[model samples]
Target: MEFKICEVLRVKRLGKKFYEIYVKYEEEPEPGTFAMVWLPDFEAIPLSFAGWTNGIARFLVKVVGPTTAALYNATKVGISKPLGRRAPIPLSTPTYVAGGVGVAPFLYMKEKWGGKILYGARTKEEIPKFIKEEIDEIATEDGSIGFKGNVVDMFFTKPKTRDVYVCGPYPMIEYFRKRAKEIGNIKAYFSTERPVKCGIGICGACTINGKLLCKEPWILMS
Candidate 1:
């Protein structure tokens, strides 16, 4: 993969500890692709492409370790041109179900293909403001928001047999795969949440159920 030195055009605090970053990059990658963001000393970490417009690329950053913490405050960084295959999105209406930073990729998808969004978080405050701006509904486990339950549970309340895109932790992905079978005609696409070390498929760092995340299409149909 090619690397480009980019300037952090802007950074905005989303909600609580999350930060939304806009990097000056010209690459207009399709939805469901990821980029490897890194600094001089910090390690490279994969981030979902949030949005792209006017020579700028966007990403949602959550401070998890040194790499991400540095990213939150970065003024300049090196990013690999968008990697991974574009997620397969059907022409039919889609419902994006996201958790935490998993909402990043769907941001662009939502713009390209309008759809209902069911965003979930542990508490009301845990849901980022950017997500709130684009999402159609919210579900917080603490009952502090639109619905009082996990996103999966909220989705089941009135299941729409439409194109379903699932992005979250392993449990959420597995739950959707196992449970959504009952929802006949639910064309679900699942994204792996594992950390991708090498942008290419050689490294097994981001393998889930023997599937390599970086090499395979971003979302796997099940």
Candidate 2:
């Protein structure tokens, strides 16, 4: 129930819709956690912890709703107590598979666990230019980027031997989940795309398979 009033340090536009918003937090939040950010005169929404560096908490936000639009315009925000838990570090090298803004959490993840990135987007323009240096492979639906297809298509181009961590749409997550189930040796976990509200778990939203995202163990294993 504790709220942290943080000052928005800066907001940098990454792509057409992707943004990196920085805020000064009193206490640093761990990677893989999330916050229910309350924008002034706008709605409170769930945001994955992108990173925390130099006393700043980073949020990779994509403006998709009126509240996010309002957040995009604000200079200050109210961040609820950090939620969720740190993702387990895989024994083998990690393979981060991200889709669109879902790439947020991996930004923090890649720091501790160095790995390759298999990023997917709709087009070249949709890809965040800032992460160009980190992306090992790319798949765009429009062939305007690295590979001319979706993430799943590129996933099989070569053998994936490392542990897989994914965050994206349900279909994409399900694709990898099914693959892991079939392969039997591929360790995989995915962040759900379910809607989250009332970060305290009072709303009963953001529940997938009876698991609450706001609580510990936010990512689900395959």
Question: Against the true structure, whose lDDT is highest?
Answer: 1
| Cα error of candidate 2 at position 177, Å | 2.2
Q: How many clashing residue pairs appear in each of the predictions shown?
A: 0, 0
Tens digits of per-residue lDDT for model 1, 36-71: 988988778898888889889999988788888778
Colliding pairs, model 2: none
User: How close to the true structure is residue 106 of candidate 1, measured as C-alpha lDDT?
Assistant: 88
Root-mean-square deviation of each candidate, in angstroms? 1.4, 1.7
Per-candidate Cα lDDT values, in order, are: 0.83, 0.80
lDDT of 1: 0.83
> Each model's TM-score, in the order given?
0.95, 0.92
Model 2 lDDT vs. the true structure?
0.80
Name model 1 segments beyond 4 Å from true: none
